[model samples]
Target: MGEQRKVLVTGASRGIGRAICNRLHADGYAVVGIARTRPADLPEGMDFHCADLSSAEDLRGLLKKLAAQGPYHGLVNNVGLVQSDPLADVLLEDLHRAVALNLEAAILCAQALIGGMREAGFGRIVNISSRAALGKQSRTIYSATKAGVIGMTRTWALEFAAQGVTVNAVAPGPIATEFFWDANPDRDATTAKLLAAIPVGRIGEPDDVANAVAYLLDRRTGFVTGQTHFVCGGMTVGAA
Candidate 1:
């Protein structure tokens, strides 16, 4: 074998991000995971970097450090902010925060990393989106931010296609991660309603989304770009 390809994953301490880190590393990528908190049980074959991704200055500093260290050919923009507020009750501060982390941060990271990828003449960018991007109750800002991610994915894919880079989005639906449990602690009638709608009749796992991302990141899949893969247990298929 040769040297393992390097990948940078954001929000990678747990949940879907952590799963992506594991999956990519298993696929022979040198995985560097960035998150606010370092995982005590870090996965094998992965390195961890602790940073507040939502902070522009901190992200810039992290990028500078990574730049000085080496180039990263693969990037997973898995950092996001999910806020639950009705449209009428949405706060500007909440919207700003969501956009800053969910949308702006991804753009900034891409901007910072694309140079190294350009030099390498190969890259893969996977943005973690959500089914909520399609629309959801009490997800005004969250929906907007995720939708923005999709838009950026498409534009970046187009811009980088000629340079051997692919950009895509993975929109997960009703995954059983910590974020899901925390958001639906009661698991009441609303939970039942959600389950009833999923055609698969179960919550999705983090690995489900990770698998889709792994596909997009594969070296053989360079021709596939600007696509939004929905790993939503058929939830995006409509009454299935």
Candidate 2:
């Protein structure tokens, strides 16, 4: 078994983030979870540090302190927020919040952690993107910010690749998570369409995405940097 590797997962209170933590922990990684709220119950030996990713100062402070205390072997950027308003109707505050939480904070965290990772000569940075970032509609604000994340993934993949650090992105289409309902309280009808569109004919679960993340972090997948893997039941292929 590999020695317990150090990993830091953002937005790990619940849903996909929580699942990712569980997966890595089982694989013998020392996992630290960060979120606005702490989960009621997590695996034993798990460490959690709560912080608001939307705040610039909070983002910088938390990441710097964490890096000082750790030569983290892995970083998972899973924290994100969405705005349900149309381009013609989005508010400035919501737009700022979307970009801040989804893209800006992620970039800052990497800036603070990448140096340590490089010095350690090994690191795994997984940017949790969305198929919505690839090509979608009516999500102008959320899409723009998410698309930036994909770009960041590609750029950093190259920068970290030769340094023994692997940077990749996993864009999940739609999984049944608390954030989904929070974004669309009346979006249940989209389920049938989603399942029909997915070749698998089933909506995804947290574990499904978590499994994909685990694979990308595999030692053998080191050569797989700068690639965005879609864990959306082949949504990247087509809806048909």
Candidate 3:
């Protein structure tokens, strides 16, 4: 590659975010990783930033710094907060938290970076949505916000098409990240039930999702915009 194109990835401390950073860096992109805390094992030469995306003050400050340092060529909105609660028991506070991190942060980040992209006439944005957006029990808030992400992706894709930018989403089904293990602890009935619902027979991995994000963020992918690619092992269609 000539000069390395710069990309920003949120929730980059571990799991899918970390995998994306590693893959992009290996692919010769200048990767900037953002998360609430720094990871000790971040790839050498990769930049890391800490910011609580849910906090408006923190996000504003971080965005300002990133703008000054950026003109970044790509962005991966991967930070998300999931509050799994039944509709009857859902808390308003959890809903707000989910909206702030899962929805608002992505919108604001794109708004902050789109101007530079417009000027440069090149950019890629990949939002990490969820298969649950299709409708899952106890995912009311998450589904709503993720669905909103898809809406934003489509709208932004249309708005930015003429400007040489593309916006898309990667909706992952069940991935075996720390969050997944935490939510589905013991290899018990719940875990078995969940596994039975996946056509692939095994849960997905972080790299599986990272690969999808990389494809969407590739410069050559400009024509593939406003689409939601589900990396759900066929769960989106139906169980095997």
Candidate 4:
């Protein structure tokens, strides 16, 4: 057997990131996970790196170390900041934070890793965007940043096609993650509304998004690139 392909996943301490890490590992890939802090429930045999991706200095240092590690076959830019603020009341700080983590981190991570992929003549990149990118209330900053992510995905897809690299985005709807419950506690009115909006009649799970990422990262999926797959419980059918 050959050496296992290695994949790097950011924001991998919890939620969709954690699911993706586990799924990819189960699929016979060497998974390297990055987050602001180490997760207590981190699976065995998976490498974990702690770095605040929102901080430019920290991200740069981490990228250097990761590049030295070398030859990663896949990357999942799943780290993001979702700030809910009305347009008129949006804070500049929140906007900057969202942009740094949601847009800038993904770009830098891809830049740091794509060279190894290009040299090897194979790579897969999946950026975690949000359904809100199409449009959402109270997601002014989040929407813009995620939309930027899709733009980057498409542009990278075009630029890296000749090198046998593929870039895609996964836009998840209202997944029932810890953050989701925290923002909408106890299945409240907001949660109820979210549920009602989904054509699937159920909130999405982290694994649902993970499944999508796995499909894109597969060795056989080289032909699929520059596309945004919506794993939003059919929410996008209505929204889009």
Candidate 5:
């Protein structure tokens, strides 16, 4: 496993981010788990970095520290946030925070690390987006940020392809994570509505999304950059 190397994952304390960290670590990579609050909970052998993704200053410092450690074989952007309010009810601060945490942080984080990935001449970046990214809706603002990530993935794939850095995105539908259910406690109705639209008839797990990400970022998937794979239990195709 000499080729096994360091991999960094943001929002690595829970849900899909945690699953990705575990999967990569099991696959022999040295995992760097990033989370503003939960860094201490990360498993052994996985390094931790604390930083609030919504704060540009904090993000800059985190990236600086990460770069000082040298090249990474992979990077996973799994941090994002959105308000539960209706569009009209969303405060200006919430709007800024959503876009800032979901999009700006991603862009800055990537910019900070892309150089080392390029220098290594071998890199993989997996961006985690939401099904909302598929189209504009009442959830337009959050969707916009996620959509931007897909755009970034495509552009960076082209920009870094020749340098051996492949960038890709994974869009997931509503998952069965506790955070999601807690955010929308009308649990039964939500599940019914989601399942009604999805052919899979079931909600997704963090592991489902994690596996998809692992594939795209795997060295064997170098030819798979600039693409976004839908990890949405058939939701994206209107099968639900």
Candidate 6:
């Protein structure tokens, strides 16, 4: 594959982002991976770009470089941050940072490469959100940011529909990744409660979410934009 078939994925060093990169690469697309730290075990054929997405200036500069590369075939906004803080104790800085990294970065990154997609008349954009966006006790800011991502996904889908560009969102729930373990430690009652609430009776793997993203990015799914694909293992079926 060449630049015409290139796909950019942020937060590609770990978790769902890494899985998406691998899946797209396996599907014969040139993968461009972005993250603050480069992973030692990134898959072959995947190019890495290191940058802190939380910094607006840094993210803009990175996008500029990516734009210079020309016409990405796909974009996966899988970079995000989650913080568990009660409403009263939540810091303004935390909220601002969450909005910047989780929401703003995705929008800016999309704007950076959408022009080429428009000219080429084909593109796939996937924004990774969280089931917590529905509502969660301690994830107020995080949920808000993810919810904002959903809104942008819908709007972009409409804006680019006629241009042959599709925009959609994937919301994962209770995925068993390093980020989950680091945020909610094992042996905690809250963790147990979350597990019990999952109708699957098991935690989801990063590949579960990755597979859904791959489907949406497929050329066959060009008619499936402006929708939120919940990779939540049936957790969103009822009041869990």
Between candidates 1 and 4, which one is better according to TM-score? 4
RMSD of each: 1.7, 2.1, 1.8, 1.4, 2.1, 1.3
Candidate 3 residue spans exceeding 4 A from truth = 1-4, 238-240
Model 1 RMSD vs true structure = 1.7
* CA error at residue 50 for candidate 3, angstroms: 0.9
Candidate 5 C-alpha lDDT tens digits along 1-240? 333378888888888888888888887888888877774456786788778888899889878988787888888999988556667776777778888888888888788888888888899998988877876345666777888888988998899999999899998887877667765564477656756777788778999988998898788887888988898888778532
Comparing 1 and 5 on TM-score, the stronger one: 1
Give the true-structure RMSD of model 5. Answer: 2.1
TM-score of 2: 0.93
Of candidates 4 and 3, the better by lDDT: 4
Off by over 4 Å in 2: 1-4, 184-188, 238-240
lDDT of 6 by residue, 156-185 (tens): 999999999999999999998988998788
Residue 83 C-alpha lDDT in model 6:
86
Candidates 1 and 4 compared by lDDT, better number: 4
User: How big is the positional error of residue 82 in model 1, measured in Å on the Cα after superposition?
Assistant: 1.1
**Whole-model lDDT per candidate:** 0.88, 0.84, 0.88, 0.90, 0.81, 0.90
Model 4 over residues 100-205: C-alpha lDDT tens digits? 9998899889989999999989999999998989998888999999999999999999999999999999999889898777756755887787889888788899
Clashing residue pairs, backbone N/CA/C < 3 A, model 1:
none
lDDT of 1 by residue, 74-145 (tens): 899998887987789999998988888998789888988898787778889999999999998999898899
**Per-residue lDDT for 13 in model 4?**
92
Taking all chains together, each candidate's TM-score versus the true structure is: 0.95, 0.93, 0.95, 0.96, 0.92, 0.96
- lDDT of each residue in 192-220, candidate 2, tens digit only: 55557877777789999899899988777
* Deviating ranges (above 4 Å) for candidate 1: 1-4, 238-240
Clashing pairs in 2: none
